[model samples]
Target: MSPIIENFEKSVNTLLLVSTLVATVTFAGAFTVPGGYNSPGKGFYIFVICDSIAMYSSIIAAVALIWAQLGDVTLLLDALHLAVPFLGVALSMMSMTFTAGLFLAVNKLR
Candidate 1:
């Protein structure tokens, strides 16, 4: 295989591993915390479910990216599959980070 392909495979593998670990940790944390999702409140469970879905989708996307990098399919097809969940993960992470940062900034200003 070409050096470029080898490097791409390595990078995709690394990303897949990292994303899988992060997803696992996030899911575990969400489940372990009391009232994290089990609270008798509005939308708590829904939020937890959505977070879980996002994390899982990220992991799946990472796996697909790695598989594509390993030369499983045409480059275009692989890219298309990878792009969908890559965007999903990116959007989810950015939204969560921005929300947390905004909350912290507002709290500090108060």
Candidate 2:
């Protein structure tokens, strides 16, 4: 492997781990919803939407990372570019999901 590819491998490994974790957590969050199913407020809807987005985006990023493993320089670069942005989107959405879930949970106490 070239030095460039080797460098990318390290990054790919890190990103793959992150995307996988985000996907798993978001998938779980989808089921164990905050405020329960009985009360569907704005925060509940926001949590649902953001959780779905985070889960799907992270799954896509994981797929892209798998593609990056093909070992072709051009393909690896393309896949990395695609995966990184999706990973970022997944992470941001995950944060939004957490905030929304918190809001829903806290609001339920009022």
Candidate 3:
């Protein structure tokens, strides 16, 4: 591969590693923090669930990227594997919005 392609692959792999570490740390923090889930706000729950899913997805994508690199998968397959985490992020944002609305509705009812 050309120097440019090699550099790009290195950068992508580094990003995947960093993202996986961050997700792991965040998940650990969620467990360690007190009152992490006691809030009356639905947004908190939504965020927690979203974060959990996003973290797992990121970890999966990172592993998939490593597999692709080792197994000489097609570039398109590698790209698709890398792109999955962004979808998780998008879904997390949607969950945040829906959770906020749900909390507001519940509060109004009470």
- RMSD (Å) of each candidate, 1 decimal: 5.1, 0.9, 5.6
**Can you rank all candidates by lDDT, best first?**
2, 3, 1
Question: Which is the better candidate, 1 or 2, if ranked by TM-score?
Answer: 2
Model 2: CA > 4 A from native: none
lDDT tens per residue, model 1, 9-98: 666666666666656665664555333333433334444555566576666766676566646547635754574567467447635643
- Model 2's alpha-carbon lDDT is 0.91
Clash statistics: count for each candidate: 0, 0, 0
TM of each candidate vs. truth: 0.57, 0.95, 0.58
Judging by TM-score against the true structure, name the best candidate. 2
Model 2 worst lDDT window (10 residues): 101-110
For each candidate, the alpha-carbon lDDT, in order, equals 0.56, 0.91, 0.57
Spell out the clash pairs found in candidate 2. none
Candidate 2 per-residue lDDT over residues 1-110, each given as its tens digit? 67878999889888999999999999999999988988777888899999999999999999999888887888888989999999999999999999998888888464
